[model samples]
Target: MPQMLLIVEPIGQRAERGRADGEAVYQRMLDFAAELQAEGLLLGVNSLGSAAKRLAKRDGGAQVWDGPFAEAKEMVGGYFLLDTEDEGVAMAWAERCPAAEWATVEIRGVGPCYM
Candidate 1:
């Protein structure tokens, strides 16, 4: 089976609506993931929080930056790893995502890993 990753961007102008609406959208996302799993198309799903830590190499050792990434216009909110036959099927699945209307969903094929 081919594997694909669905990158979900949850931060945007429309996404800042209201607390109740945000919760509703979150529930819908969970429901959609459950439906995908029930159909055996979902391998895994992850919800990413706003907090992030960036690591970098400087002159001597490591440098770190923390985030809610104040300057970013969009941040990845979550992802869905899908197992399917081909890109067409994966694209169809991506199209059915609950937040597709307001958020950005990027579908990318998973390549073989050396490690």
Candidate 2:
């Protein structure tokens, strides 16, 4: 099965509020994940730490930069790895994501995670 990477770019004040909300965003995500799991579309989910630790190799050499501070309004807050053949279907799933309504969810290829 082809794998689709759901780059969950969480944003907005609501997201910040969500962080403090008991279950946090998990409460919202769980429902969505359940739906996907029911359809056998979801594979895995992960939340990244503050971007502050992000390293970079910009240009042809290594150049470290400060992180945890994202310039984009929609920051890459988390990710959901889905196993699906139809990208459209995956997109449909992304549409229902709560973040998209208030923020954004970037759907991209998972690339080589094992690499």
Candidate 3:
């Protein structure tokens, strides 16, 4: 079995005006994650801060960018560290994700860090 990082991106405005009701949806999303955790399927899940507070590192200087990195349908607002046997199993979880049908889940494996 391998550990995979499941990054979730919301396809619509998740934290903005007119989307105030989004809080409820967000709560549901949390509930789903909790359920997964209780089943020992999910290792951990975390929500990221607004993209407005993001900083990009270049050659020398750090560039501060606005929140919500892209104008696409969704933005990566959170992630889950999944402990799964393979990508197929991980995809199964992603398909069940509340945000999956609408949002996108980018799966990445933990790589070796050369000393």
Candidate 4:
């Protein structure tokens, strides 16, 4: 099994940090990723930009919307995919994540949607 660590952050949080602070925080994340890679636990990692698009099909029509969505209080800042079968190990890594200091590290198992 694989687990994903979603870095959920409040909207505008990055802007509040400003460029310098943001860069510093990002460096910390990179260092963390390197540690995971060294441990052979990291499968993939990426930081998400604020810009996003939402698409939906309704009534036989496709609708699309561009964000920053006003209704959303939080956004996914990044993700880390870990190769592991133990949920406990994933949870431990999530706790060690740099984002855990300023954001929510959501741990979710990789599985079929139907499951």
Q: Find the candidate with the highest lDDT and give its number.
A: 4
Model 2, span 1-115: residue lDDT tens: 4555445454554445655672656578877778778888778877655445556686788766675456655556667778876778778888888657555677776656764
C-alpha lDDT of all candidate models, in order = 0.77, 0.66, 0.68, 0.97
lDDT comparison, 3 vs 4, better candidate: 4
Judge candidate 1 against the unseen true structure and give its global Cα lDDT, from 0 to 1: 0.77
Clashing pairs for model 1 are none
Error of 3 at 54 (Å): 5.1
How close is every model to the real structure, measured as TM-score?
Answer: 0.81, 0.68, 0.67, 0.97
Candidate 1, poorest ten consecutive residues by summed lDDT: 6-15
Greater TM-score among 1 and 4 belongs to 4
Task: Give residue 46's lDDT in candidate 2 (0 to 100).
Answer: 71
Per-residue lDDT tens digits for candidate 1, residues 8-63, read: 56555434677888788789989988988899888888877767899999888998
Candidate 4 off by > 4 Å: none
List all candidate RMSDs to the true structure.
2.7, 4.0, 3.6, 0.7
Over 4 Å off in model 1, which ranges? Answer: 10-15, 58-60, 113-115
The C-alpha local distance difference test score for the whole of candidate 4 amounts to 0.97
